[model samples]
Target: MDATGDVILVQGGGSVAATRQTSRTMKRTANLQERLQEKSHAVGERADAVVAPLHGGAGGESELADKAGKSQMLEDASGNNVSLMRTMLRAMLHETSTQLMDEQKKMLERLWDALMGNQRMTTQMMGEQLEMVRQLQQEVQAVKTQAVEESRKVDELRRLHEQSTRQLRVMQEQTSEQIRTTREQTTEQLKIIREQTAQNFEQMRLQVMKEVGIV
Candidate 1:
């Protein structure tokens, strides 16, 4: 084949790959939005259902039904807005997670650069370099601690949400599979974050040690 033909083929392949990736991203976004809408609608339905059982079952059945109907209408309207907000919130979370990952990469690069700088240190500066390593280790530990705390908060929020979801399910007679799935997802995300942080920390330590000729 000619060089020009080869070039065209490569460009075409790249374009196809990029298009596929974009299509996947759009599909995922649409799925997330749909899930958010379902959740919002479910919450509203549960609320309306609960109100009727709580206030009816007597001579006030008609009145209760009317009130519940009105409440459901209001909830349905608000649910649309809530679903949009939740979709936006999920997008924000994805953006934040991506930013954190990028920050971690930048930090590791900086640490490697610092270690490279120390490779030319004389014997006299070895102790100082070791101290700097210690300081960096301490900083990494602090970051790990912060990450743990953040994971704890995330878990707490997940538990609270699960509890609320469970209560709603019990009130309306439903399943716990969705709750379990949500918890698992949250736990998996936290696990990934923790693993990445630890991996970066170890890499930094090893790099520092290599620079000091300890490895």
Candidate 2:
């Protein structure tokens, strides 16, 4: 009876130790499960930071392409304006040259007309001077002919005066000869009458003395 009692007590103590060891093992397993859940949440936050930068870079590249297209269009418009200005300048130069040529031709025509008018005036003046000289020569010749006719009439009048003086001297000599012949005939008749008268006176004295006796 004493050994049997000792074996029963020993078996009961062994059973109690076994139950305490099982309870310690269950507590260690619950702590390990909580640490694994915290590690998973950290990995999800890192992935979100990487994806945001890639999305922003794609939008920036599209904006740069639009600005380059606008710059090319402005350069083409400026080149067309320069070409139009050059064409207008060339046309103005051609019109100015044409006007200058017309003015030069008109000046030459005026000079030619002036020369022809001067030549006609010189010819008319020469003809008038020649006619005046011819008239003066004709007047001088008529005056010389009148002077010669007056000289011939003076010589004929001198010859008629000399013939009249010779006729007057011959008439005076004939009258003197006729007066001497008449005086000689009258003296002979007076001498015969004186002798007859003396004889008659003597006869008359003798007769008267006989009658009266006193004679």
Candidate 3:
């Protein structure tokens, strides 16, 4: 139970104990009062019976009157004392009850205020946790989006690399074909120049022989 409930439960136990104590006190007092009254009546009866024969009825008259008056006074005093005791008990009970009630009220108020304060704190903590969850979710979403963008860039880069590779292969094959054709042309030009030089040398030698024979 909460503090208020626990206090109320404890108070209930106290009230029960107080009630039992008061009941026992009242019962004991009532029994004592009955015994006292019975004893007083028995004493008065025995005294009258025993003393009546000891004197003539004329002398006993004043004494009997005195005894009766004393008994009556004792009964009155006892009654007054009983009344006073009852009044005192009632006052004590009332005061105790009032004090208990006041204390209980104060305790309940304090417990209620504490409960409310704890509730507010719990609510604030829950709100903070919810906000944290929202922020974490946003961060997770941002990370997912960034990862997707990076993946897309990697795919684009792969496509570009494949295209560049194909273009480089085609250029290399074209350059190799050009180099082979230039090599064949250069060999054919060298062969034709060598044949022309040989014919020119043979003609110069015959013209020199004719000049020599004429001289």
Candidate 4:
């Protein structure tokens, strides 16, 4: 028998080397067993051929022929029994080999399924991780945008405060200048009033002196 069929059956199914080795071993063993069986059968045939004619009795050739027939029948039965044993052993070996092959197939299937499941889970996890990273990036971008907006608002407020401060300084300076101008104007007006009052008093004195007839 060729082990190639068995080798092909196990190809790409996983455990190829072991299966091939086992197949070769099984083939060798089967061949050996078959050779042994053939040898046994040949020995039985030769023995029967040799022993069938040895029982000659006083009944002469008929008795001898009957004994030969009986021996032949016994040999045939023994051969049948041997053939049955070989068939049974072959069936047992076939069953065992089939069972082993089935187990290997099932194991390989389970491993494949597990590997696929793991790969799927790993891919899903990587996807989830990528999504999380994307979300994190978005969040970081949002935070940066918010920070920029806040910074811009702070800058606007600082500018406004500076402008207000400048306006306040300008107003204070203008108020001081206006107060100084008012003080100067009041002083000049008071000087003019004093001079006019003095002039009028002098004129009144002259008029009184002239009216007193000292002209």
Give the true-structure RMSD of model 3.
Answer: 8.5
Q: Give the alpha carbon lDDT tens digit for every residue of 73-151 in model 4.
A: 6677667767877786677567657766786788789899999999999999999999999999999999999999999
| lDDT tens digits, residue span 9-128, model 2 | 433544443243333323433443343333333333333344444555557664444334333433443343344334533443343334333433444555567767776766666666
Candidate 4 is scored at a TM of 0.57
Question: What value does the lDDT take at residue 91 in candidate 2?
Answer: 44
Candidate 2 lDDT (Cα, whole model)? 0.46
- Report, for every candidate in turn, its global Cα lDDT versus the true structure: 0.70, 0.46, 0.72, 0.77
Number of the top lDDT candidate? 4
By TM-score, the better pick of 1 and 2 is: 1
Q: Tell me the TM-score of model 2.
A: 0.25
Q: Candidate 1's C-alpha lDDT?
A: 0.70
State every prediction's TM-score relative to the real structure.
0.27, 0.25, 0.54, 0.57
Q: Over 4 Å off in model 1, which ranges?
A: 1-14, 54-215
User: Which parts of model 2 are misplaced by more than 4 Å?
Assistant: 1-101, 141-215
Ranked candidates (TM-score, high to low): 4, 3, 1, 2
Q: What is the lDDT of residue 39 in candidate 3?
A: 61
Score candidate 3 by TM-score against the native.
0.54
